[model samples]
Target: MTPPAALTLEFVSKHNVEGDLWIIVDSSVYDISKFATIHPGGLSVLLNGDIAGQDATKAFYGLHRSEILRRPQYARLKIGELVGRDEQQQNVPPDAIGSTSSIPYAEPTWLAPGYRSPYYKDSHRQFQLAVRQFVEDVIFPDAQRHEEDGKPPSQHVFDEMGRLNIIAMRLGPGKHLQGRALMRGIVKPEEFDHFHELIIAQELGRIHARGYSDGLGGGTCIGLPPILNFGKPVLRDKIVPDVLAGKKFISLAVTEAFAGSDVAGLKCHAKRVKDGWVVTGTYARLPESPKDRSVYVPLFSVFAARTDAGGLVVLVIPRSDGVQTKLIKTSYSTAAGTAYVTFDEVHVPYENTLGSDNGGLQVILSNFNHERWGLTCGAVSAQRTILEECLKWATQREVFGKPLASQAVVRSKLAQMIARVETSQNWLESITFQMVHMNYKEQASKLAGQIAFLKMFTSRNAQDTARDAVQLFGGRGITRSGMGKFIEHYHRTLLIDAVGGGAEDVLGDLGVRQALRMMPKNVRL
Candidate 1:
């Protein structure tokens, strides 16, 4: 309740002995006298003459991340301010929470100051700011905590997302959002477009926790769109309102044990029965399927299965007597709720069919362009974050008594990282513009291959960027914490982009196949 005392440098200088020590970081003074004995680096590291009673801002930053100071115990060590606002930390409380980065190439050029964009209007920019603030205040902290503990996102996050109607917005522009007050009316429903949704994905990706990012309504973003576009009115009314409200969960159950991305190769079968169908199949690695049985009871999912005569169909199946789920531990954190799901003779209502029984391929393909495009946006944003981190590390970190950026090799890696992310971002934005301008059918016919190629390019480049970032950071890059924590995590999880929605090789082949279909009949070659 009381203000911290204001102290001057001279008075703090005398208390430099073992029993008493003082240091200034970003102009705020910390009395690490008692803490010195218990400091993680040990008393000797804190007792150095240059740090014990001096302005150690640069030295501290060189060795530790700023977040270390934000921890309760370390923050409690701050006994007073250093008596000058101009010299104080730029991130002082109440003002420092969610400001955009000053680092060049940290954010998309459109988000950078003194930069202009043709795609984002005032509303999109405003919406992006609002979402970034929420993600910083809420999602990011939880992301770090859960990513380590391997737990799903907190319920408060789900409730907060629902309060903002973020779940529906992530599904992108649709009739489902007609009456909703999105972002507290920051943008009207009709005014909402794919770019707005892109902003949400990119902003959320800044959390730097890939597994946690997917857990935060990953299912709703990729799965619910099918229901919105194809489910019958009665089915839509029954399912849409509740799921959008964040009261329920749904995941796209397409990948199986045998069929990863080859949609036509899925062997899950549905036998015709009275009033509904009997589904028996396994849906593997469903992103964030509700695994908590007591709270959510039955997992609600929309999956693709083969009907009689070997025709693939898409249907909604609720958790029931024949349903089962087993968590699939992965290299990434378990916060994503990645599971291997089995449905043995599960009964789904006839009205639950997403589209015509045999049109599963079409039903699935209709959403693929949007899903793949969203993946590109997320991948570009994520890769860009890594680039910013690498840039910061290279600039601040000292190697051989000079800034790491001074090294010719480090600079070259940085250049390569920058080029990959910037090119991917440009391609992603161009495709986004097409999505905004074209109709759904037109998009499927014309933009499918383009989206596939864009995803392939973005994902492969992300792999390269991750490699360069790790190489630049060296040992620290591989370490899970400290200067290269994000770089390490990114290197470990970057594969999801290349393989999740579709494998890079498959996507590249599909793009070529699409091009082949549109080739001129009278080609000389």
Candidate 2:
């Protein structure tokens, strides 16, 4: 809809009272009167006499980031532009508005009009738009709320994701998504590729609340794949549909107190029982299990454990009689439901065993490539976001009577951050390109080492980006509220990506080991 005609400063001043309050920011006007009471910061800040009848650009930036002004909540309040500003200059072309942010490197290069990418096509673009809209309109608000409340996303959020077929699409390209209407009809199932999956991960990472991101669907992103790929057809048919539809929640139960990245070292053991298998073990701290079955379903856990044969086994254990969960608090919020799960002789039917008994290592290993790739995608996007935050903060914040961007030291940091982010993103795209062209078996053999290195490199870049971002954001960066929220949250949870998929040291070594296996037999060093 066209914005109401530009309003003069005099006209804005008249509506400054409690019931009809309006304020200007960057030459655009917002009617935030109705939003005052519900503002997360508080109502008094808006009602304060000093803010009435004035442009609130300074105060707004002081308490909130620029993204707030761009959110749909604030967008709807924007009735018009300031009277003296040039309309053409102030207005973004309709088509270009959300395609890319004005900040450099904030989005993929392909999203920028002048740039081109052979990897992305019209379907990819359509998919990106649909996912972005869904994230902004549906997921982001819930993420913000749950991030603060330390609760998982509401069922409505999951239901909406199910409706969009996002839960299924997130597993990366596969037969699972085939024949399904994806992203609510924006892209066909056959057209979905790794690039499309990458777009989803990056777009969701834009939420910037890692805990909330995990809480929303992050667990299922890594957890449900084993069941989908290796579970018996009867088992897959029984649970996969419900989980993908967001009626239930599942997690990959592999990490233990004794073993993290060293999957082979896991002590969780499965013993043969009369009818099936008896599994008993403890998972590394993860989020809490859902309490309400109607609103949520803690459906399944793909438990990886050792059998009597001294080889690994994977079981699809439903939340049942002997299963127990306790919440484990971490640096980030509890929204992720990070829990300490215990399977006390939990009985799993023989039919629930995924892949071959005592040969489940490959099943688990196969899932890691995509899992790490997803983490790499998120890490790179997050660093880009951090760079964007630094750029905006430097330009707007003043130090020693000049903008922070004017300082040579800050400029150097920004340059380094941008370079790292761009390089990682380019590498990630290249790997994704290979994924699109190669089949699953080819990817497993050819791209494993490359993906591992990419994850390691991207995560290492995140560590640097987070540190630099914290330095740039200063006191606000360390603080949780106000202008530095994204920086602070990212800094606190950056290790999740670095360590969760695979620790940097382990992955770096694994990449080298894998590459050596593919080394030429007779070539000189």
| Candidate 2 C-alpha lDDT tens digits along 1-525 | 233476888878877677678888768888878887687767777777667657877677666766666678778988877888765436443324235577777778999768999889998888888788888778888888888888888889889888889989889878898889887778888888889899999998888788888877777887788888888899988988988888878877678889877899989989988788998888864342353633222667778889999999988888787988777788877888887788898889999998998889988898989988998888888788888889989988887878899999999999999899889989999999999999999999999999999998888888888999999999999988778988998999999888877889899999999989988998895
Scored by CA lDDT, what does every candidate get?
A: 0.84, 0.82
In terms of lDDT, model 1 sits at 0.84
Worst 10 residues of 2 by lDDT: 288-297
Best by lDDT: 1
**Can you give the TM-score per candidate against the true fold?**
0.94, 0.87
Candidate 1 lDDT, tens digit per residue, 107-161?
A: 8999898999999999998898889889899889999999988888887788888
Q: Candidate 2: how large is its RMSD?
A: 4.4
TM-score of 2: 0.87
Note the residue pairs that clash in candidate 1: none
